[model samples]
Target: MNTYQHDWHTSEGYDGGLHHCRKCKRSHQGPRLEAHDCPVSDAEHHAVAWLGHAGLYRTRFDAVRNFEQSVTPVSVDELFELASKQILSQINEGCQRG
Candidate 1:
């Protein structure tokens, strides 16, 4: 729920750490925190950035497909937008609480 943590891990391709932006969930490497420019200003941006990663896109697509089966189906973009808005809201709420 709390998405403030900038998740960092050792990169296999490099000696520095890889940082995952909490808002956009995009990975960054060899960049200082101050230099990293996260492009997640809204839900749409968050969805696009998050789904831009191949692994996350496939996994989220499967999950969204199942979700659609339980309710009215929507376009791929709309589905992702809805899901992204929900996630962004939760992150904001958690940030406020913390």
Candidate 2:
């Protein structure tokens, strides 16, 4: 199977347009943060597993580190779900403040 490799950093400063959340259909505003490289791929494939909004990491090691620090022994899918909710809550709070 052929795999596509992406350099996520290249798009960091560029306004590639807004991203819409598939589950919530909420418009994710502003310039998106670049996905960190996957440590498993040695920084080749920027594999992004959605968490809350989106967690960007440069490596699998970093992703694991984040999960370890932020969450308990949950599966990736569960972690992502939790993270997504966390992000959405933060955003909602910010909107309320504004």
Candidate 3:
């Protein structure tokens, strides 16, 4: 495992903008980043780790906020389907390249 220091970046806004890591995609919902543990490596983990809800911390910070604020109707089933399809596409592409 390769532990990495967080490179925290803040969004441009006045409302105590979010601070998120550019590497592991961990996010904090405030202007200041508090202490937290990031993933040890950049390697991908099991899909179960982030295959369900859109609120997963691994998601981009801005995406989470936008999703929360949007009134559009989105179902978890659809999210899962979209995510799975993308994942399968990536895997197939990688396999073909290899």
* Each prediction's TM-score versus the true structure: 0.28, 0.28, 0.32
The RMSD (Cα, Å) of candidate 1 is 15.1
- What are the clashing pairs of model 2? 36-57, 36-58, 37-58, 37-59, 39-59, 39-60, 51-84, 52-83, 52-84
Candidate 2 matches the true fold with a TM-score of 0.28
- Top candidate, metric TM-score: 3
TM-score of 1: 0.28
Backbone clash pairs for candidate 1 read none
lDDT of each: 0.51, 0.45, 0.56
lDDT per residue for candidate 1 within 2-87, as digits (tens), equals: 22334344444454556666556667777536543544344433343223322233343564654533222244686677689989
Rank ordering of all candidates by TM-score, starting from the highest: 3, 2, 1
lDDT of 3: 0.56
Better of 1 and 3 by TM-score: 3
User: What overall lDDT, based on C-alpha atoms, would model 2 receive against the true structure?
Assistant: 0.45
